[model samples]
Target: MILAAGQPDAPLLELFLAATAGNVLGAVVNFVLGRFLLRFEHNRWFPVSPANRQRAEALFNRYGRLVLLFSWLPVIGDPLTLAAGLLRTPLPVFLLYVTIGKAARYAVLLWAYTTLAG
Candidate 1:
């Protein structure tokens, strides 16, 4: 979608807005899921083990919400957003960082595409 949006005739601003909005929205979903999932922490069917959860929480505490800046990374991005929610990161803080990261990612990609294609 992003690559296609970078085509020469594409409406850059509109495409950028759409891409960023969708990406940030997806992250929000992950954040919400993380928050919701925590309610099942003690349930037998909970996926994450308690020890693993504790270790993740410790790491999140060490790094803090700044990790949300990397929320555009592929494999780790989704998990990072999710972790933010699991750790009870403030929604406003999460949105600010996540939006910046996601928007920057698309902007960079578009810039690179336009530069190379030209």
Candidate 2:
């Protein structure tokens, strides 16, 4: 919505900051949920399937903390954060990486809007 709007009502800096903050907060919630819900694996209502969980775990293992850099992606993003929590990733580390990813994503979107819309 923000990207497609072309010209947002709010200032670009405000938009960027708000989007980054909201996305990071959401990821944090997902992480906490993952931490507490570790024992609820395989339930029908689980957001991530067993296959997705395995894949996320594999990626996290292979890339270490760096994989959180892609946590802004759509389908796999939530699982990545959840996996980080399930794996007991440090809060400071998760916040740092996820904030960078989401801020970069919004910055790119804003740049594209300016470049292409002008």
Candidate 3:
């Protein structure tokens, strides 16, 4: 989706907005899941183990919500948003940081594509 946005005839601003909106929405979903799923941690069906949960919480606490700036990252991004939910981060704070990170990522990618390909 992002790469497609960089096509020569693509509507850059529209694509950027669409991609950012969709990506941020996804992060919101992860955050919501994490916020609610922690309640079921004791269930055998829970995906995350207690030890892992503690470790994730520890990392999140140590780094704080500022880490949300990297929420645009691939492997760790989704989990980071989830951690925010688990830690009960404020929704506004989560949205602000996550949006900034995701939007910046797409902006950089678009700029690079234009610069290199133009």
Taking all chains together, the TM-score of candidate 2 against the true structure is 0.77
TM-scores for all predictions: 0.88, 0.77, 0.84
Q: Could you give the C-alpha RMSD of every candidate to the true structure, in order shown?
A: 2.5, 4.4, 2.8
Predictions in order: lDDT:
0.90, 0.86, 0.91
Ranked by lDDT, top first:
3, 1, 2
Best by lDDT: 3
For model 2, how does the per-residue alpha-carbon lDDT over 1-118 read when each residue is reduced to its tens digit? 4442545464778778988999999999999988887767778987778887787678788889988999999998998898889878999999999999999999999899878876
**What tens-digit string does per-residue lDDT give for candidate 3 at 1-118?**
4446546788888888998999999999999998899799899999989898888889888988999999999899998998999878999999999999999998998899788888
Worst 10 residues of 2 by lDDT: 1-10
**If both were scored by lDDT, which would come out higher, candidate 1 or candidate 2?**
1
Please tell me which model should have the higher TM-score, number 1 or number 3.
1
- What candidate 1 gets wrong by more than 4 Å, as runs, is 1-7
Ranking by TM-score: 1, 3, 2
Q: What's the TM for model 3?
A: 0.84
